[model samples]
Target: MKNKFTLILVLFLYINLVNCDYYQSKTIVPHDLPNKVTHLHFYYFDIHTGNNPSAVIVARPNQTNEKNPKKSSLYGTVFAIDNPLREGPEETSNVVGNAQGLYVSSSQSEDVTLTMYVDYAFTSGELNGSSFSVLSRNPVREPTRELAVVGGRGKFRMATSFALIRAHFLNVTTGDGIIEYNVTIFHY
Candidate 1:
């Protein structure tokens, strides 16, 4: 009876150990690659009138242009450096990554909402070519916004984190602006 009880207890302990996600007493070693730091420039044009060529107006039922023309959506790519009015991407500049997403706002409304997905690629670093993705949401009109780090690849594989976004320049007249993003990621 004693031996049978001991065997059952040992089997239970083994199963629990195998099913556990992490071991408490195990040593956690740091990753071989260093943390990547990047400051990216997010530029938007004609944000107020939504007149930029990239901007598109989505239509909804029972919505008119004068009232609620659905919402104006704009999407474009961003760079690692701060280039407000530049026409295209600068190759000489450090190409960290790109942001391809859109923002929408009501007619004649100052409050706008945005959903941007930012992907980061290290150009020259210990973890070069390794990339991570951030899903950003702007729920209201504010000077600063926060983004969630959803996932990643390569050295940043399975990473999760967040970011802080601040508007560096916003031209109410031309409806152009430059936003800065500071991201923090946690990975294996």
Candidate 2:
């Protein structure tokens, strides 16, 4: 009888532990940007060259260059984001993370169409190393664009989320700007 009682108690404890609600549901996080610098590399194909007739190219590397050559087809950028732009990242100034991704522009017409895949990462804070990916359309031109959060890692494991992208400052010529991102994620 004693052995049976002990086994039952152990089993009950195991069950309770397994069923614990340690990881809850529906977590919403917002990154407010008063003046967050957005570093973007814009790759453009020469219309005269015809090398890229479609004018489709990849935005890469991750740095900021206003005097980037028009003929160059590759670039990099680093967005420094902190509350007041003074608190940068641990390694850098106030750079919390980065907005890295690809951009595909369809045309230069008034009805411009673009597809973008952007990834957001947190370098410091409780959510350090956590990142989320988003697929957005015409995010730059649109007043409010909703990006689909496909997946994530670290603290955001198995995260299903969305990002609201608002463009505050955009240099149409340089293709650089300061944008705001408000992300809502559901994770385990």
Candidate 3:
């Protein structure tokens, strides 16, 4: 009788062990990858002047003159932008989003570069309420600039990618310009 009881106990323990292993195998998590990629195209208006401008010069460096003023850098200068992102180059075009942030002239040399930190927040279309953050250096004179997409929110969550900003139009005297942007984002 004692040997039969011992055999039953061992059988029960074996069954519990098998069940535990089965449950554990079922609980294994699936791997998440940044496999999805998407492209977004928009136009950004750099409005530095007018009564109601989109971008404004918030700070500037002390007066300094270089032999070639045009070759001089805008170091220590800062600008704040809440620029409208539109479907077309015209400001009258339908507003899709807004690029809001601050960019500072970080280059201490002759290059007119800005250390940019901006968030593109959408207000219309499929990506409404979604936004992505950009943190990179922008050489304004470059015909095509690539900026890194650090992260994002909403549909863009866990995203990483780049943005191609090309010169669309420029007004030298007014410091107003229109830029074409093509952003590619990857996410889980």
Candidate 4:
């Protein structure tokens, strides 16, 4: 009886071990290369927020994409913008948009340029009061030439005092986007 019991216990252990290995192998192997993460971080801002007004966004890298079996080479960054003028109480002379500082993780490759863009719905207001412009001072240099987009909706009446803006940043690897940034508001 003891011999039979021992035999049964050994068989159970062997089966479990084999099954565990099989499952582990299946889970560990990838069927194909990983897709380069196309999107990294995004920023949403309410323009109605009182002046000293401005919105800033930063993209941070995540680590889940590093060990994938298949991967793509890093490229550049890209951005899209959307904004339009609005009807305002006054001919507000707010310049409305600017993008700068496209940098990369200190530990990763840095052989790329950053791209930014803006698209918007037209704001119907006093020519000067409801207007929008989008520009970037300098492009970021990194391995991936992905894109980062920023822009807003037009029309800022008393009810719609500000615009809604969205920005997206991208990277090639999980480690590329992880970053530290500072947003400053300068007022006179």
Candidate 5:
């Protein structure tokens, strides 16, 4: 009887271990190469003028904080955006996509700096419904900046690239800007 019980227990352990599908996992590199590379250029409109604005300040620094910068630098201000993307720098130009996200002024320097989180959602092309994400720090006073293309979907799936952004036109009084973007993307 003792020998039979031992044999039954050993058989149960063997069966459980032999068919353990969830016991381990394996890592693999993609068999397909990342051979598709594309370049794109567009204009991003940050319209803050008129009755209908595309971007608006949602939060501001405490007025009593002496260390906080004023509106000149916009430090500690957060803006929510649903701006337009155009084929040309002009606001009336053809609309191709939209940029929807939020940005915060995080720099204490005299020059305005923003930590931006935005997504470029394409609307009117073969790439319609596809979107790519940009999360980066932008120094607005600088002539040029490079933003990271963190991730993407649809035609831009598994994308890894950067965007060169520059202020094409800026209205200091109203805080409006038409920025240009040159993007390079690589995907499988």
Candidate 6:
């Protein structure tokens, strides 16, 4: 009787533990932006997922490991308004991660269009596809272009999306795989 009672208690505890919810803060995460822009816009590139836990991933390499075959670097670009009144002399700059401030000219004011291209290479086994999600800040009245493209080498597919001001994304997969994305954002 004691053995049965203990078994039931253990089973009950196990059920509770296994069913525990995995959750994070419900707040939306905004992408890091540069300081220099009078006007700013963001776009959605892709939504993707993995087939299994070990499939898709993103990573950066250390300096010493840069020469290693398994090592790779990711890159992106950004554009900002140019002003003459600003302290800086450059008319325009490529906005990279963590870059601060936009260039402004003193007497000459111009509305500038910035373009950014993003790329990264990572290791993955099985991949599903890329995904994009609309956030509260997304522009509503604009026409959006959406397309899905599967790669030839890796088990990957990228669903590229063009939205005026949306940035949320979710990735889903069909099989176990990994993918590297090359993204470009341009305004003219």
Would you list the C-alpha lDDT of every candidate in the order shown? 0.54, 0.52, 0.89, 0.31, 0.89, 0.26
Question: lDDT per residue, candidate 6, 6-114, as tens digits?
Answer: 9999999999878877553365433342222112232222212323222222322233434565733222111131111111112242212111122111111122222
- What candidate 5 gets wrong by more than 4 Å, as runs, is 1-28, 65-73
The candidate with the higher TM-score, 1 or 5, is 5
> What is the overall TM-score of model 4 with all chains considered together?
0.20
Residue pairs with colliding backbones in model 3 are: none
lDDT of 3 by residue, 1-188 (tens): 99999999999999888878555655533244437888999999989888999988898987676676665446888999999999999878999999999999888776578899999999998899999999999998889999999999989987899999987998866779999999999876
lDDT of 5 by residue, 1-188 (tens): 99999999999999999989885876557555556888999999998878999999999876654664442557789999999999999768999999999999999777888999999999998989988999999988889899999988988888889999999999988889999999998776
Which structure is stronger by lDDT: 4 or 5? 5
If both were scored by TM-score, which would come out higher, candidate 3 or candidate 4? 3
Candidate 1 on 1-188: residue-level lDDT in tens?
99999999999999999998776566745565455544434332223344333333353334345555674322222322212222223324444443434433332344556554556555555656776776767643587788887888887787877777666666655445555666677776
How far off is model 3, as Cα RMSD? 8.9
Estimate the TM-score of every prediction: 0.49, 0.50, 0.77, 0.20, 0.82, 0.16
- The residue pairs found clashing in candidate 1 are none
lDDT of 2 by residue, 82-119 (tens): 12111311224455565555556543344445666656
167: Cα error in model 6, Å = 3.0
Off by over 4 Å in 3: 1-34, 66-73
**Model 1 per-residue lDDT at 90:** 34
